[model samples]
Target: MESVVGNGCFRLVREMANIQGRDVFVADLYVTPTWLDPGNTDPLLHFPKDADQKDALIIPLWIPGHFLLSVMRPLQKEIFFLDSLYFRRADGFSSQAYRELLRGLAQQIVAGAWTEKTALDLKDVPKQTHGNDCGVFMIMYAWYFAMDACFDFGVDDMCLLRRWWCIVLLENFGLEGYGRKFAHFTDEGKATLRDNVPPVFRITRKRKLESPMVSEDLIQYPSLQPV
Candidate 1:
């Protein structure tokens, strides 16, 4: 069988099939750049300073929604959704537990009940790269994916914040397209990224919800600050 690699939900699918990269030429669909000619130089995908090339793919899938982005807002205008704090312990963090904390804190931040320090802590993890860069991961990815799944999802205020903050974080990291900019890429750079997608990549169409539903916990209050 040809080895096929998958991102997000693709991991489960690939695992079931026992595909390996060498056999199938597996690659992540979202992060690959199509325009890099391999002959020409493009700084966009350059590895960070002092970073090992082998260690580059160590991306975390945990994004703390607006909990980190809210505090990092003023400094950078674009935040990549891939930015995340990585814990490489043999016995490591629980994804469920961390996601619960992020959700709870995001709710509090929206409610205007979160303290300034709490916001800082969420945004300012010590081992972060990019100097004070607050990495966003899965939680943020889920929110963004929801917006892509529906227009109504994009119009919601919480969704707007998520998008805006993501943009800011990316810009801060000296990359283009975080939120709105990122969406535009879906059209502009779509050809490039799509073309670059490994041939073995499988496209999965998501079922759209019939009704525009905002998470009950995402309800907006009068006191919520303009994002």
Candidate 2:
């Protein structure tokens, strides 16, 4: 099985846009190489100059194939590392390495060597039951964080949550009828429907009234004057 999930970071970007009600700036997946790369600070510098003014920076990280999310709160000077697997190991881009890297970047961005390192918080965010669901959990984390909501769902809910995501996406793009059409189907059924439908017919149709082919004079009607 391919380790990388669909759309990678773009999925998180879309969810952020939907929940934050504003455009979210996301760095390319290539920004940070493997989490183990010592030169990971370069990606932090690549953030937009005005990134500090935004609510937070949502970063999608790839450990070779597995996925995770890193959220940086500039104003708060805090960085949160959310991993669905949460493996307890000391090596290979463990939480400590990320914390140190974030601290260095924080100091560099502030332009003050004396500036305190940003706080690093390792959250007990939701975990995935299956190996393949890390990407889904990453998306859920971004969605909940963007909306300032709690991560209340778990792995068992992922199957249904995936379908709900499609519905939300369609509704957001003004395809309510299509969203409703698939609302009652199972996720697999919805996927089959989506696969079979052509892109041109996915949108709802608008009524087009044909223009009158004959001149108004040809029509019999009561005269404007007294009949």
Candidate 3:
């Protein structure tokens, strides 16, 4: 199936425009739910690019309403539950299905891999005390997780994070760099992360988030927003 460039999470997915062809998948609830459906004739068209040649796949899932996320790293043979609220895998409907789907994805990417499947229980991940920052948190978490970048963001970093998001989107709206580079999947990643620093972008957020990413999440499903 030819992959469509769809990158989404929630309200941004009604038309189901998610990013693909880079092993990064971020689809909306209703649309991507079809991927897990047994009757789907071509589920791969949803996301998770050409798995045959890619080094890894990163799937950042958003549990609707609350929008918390679980990152599926198929190549690493593991899935990371990055819940700002510290929610458990079994705490929600979508989270529960993600584990099994990840295993399926692992098998598709590499047979018999990721067999010891388990969401690596992480305790030090930054949490959102009480705010609508879950989506923002998911975006940052996926970037740091996907790029294997340092985890320096905290509750105090939210304002900066939001502002940074704004700048990046404003500047990158017309860029064509999506699915081209993914050092984030490499053992010795060469991808440079600038989120830790101040913003130098065209400036662009608020109002359900207007992510200026090229597309795809766990593309933070850097699948941050729709095109």
Best by lDDT: 2
In Å, residue 23's CA in model 2 sits off its true spot by: 6.8
Please report the candidate that would top TM-score against the real structure: 2
Name the regions of candidate 2 deviating beyond 4 angstroms. 1-24, 34-41, 87-97, 111-124, 166-227
Candidates in order: C-alpha RMSD to true structure: 25.6, 13.5, 19.4
Clashing pairs for model 2 are none
- Relative to the true structure, how large is the alpha-carbon lDDT of every model? 0.30, 0.58, 0.49
Quote the positional error of residue 170 for candidate 1 in Å: 17
lDDT of 2 by residue, 82-190 (tens): 7776644332233566556666666654544332221123344566657587777767776666665666888888889778665555543334444433533334335
Name the runs in model 3 displaced over 4 angstroms: 1-31, 36-42, 47-49, 52-55, 87-94, 113-120, 174-227
Compared with the true structure, what per-residue lDDT tens digits does model 1 show for residues 1-227? 01121142223222322322211111233332221233333322432332221111122232223112111011112112222333332222324333333344334323333322221223332223333223223333323322222212211244454465545434333333322223323332344455643333346989987998789889877787889
Predict model 2's lDDT versus the native: 0.58
- Model 1 / residue 183 / CA error / Å: 14
Minimum summed lDDT over a 10-residue window in model 2 is located at 113-122
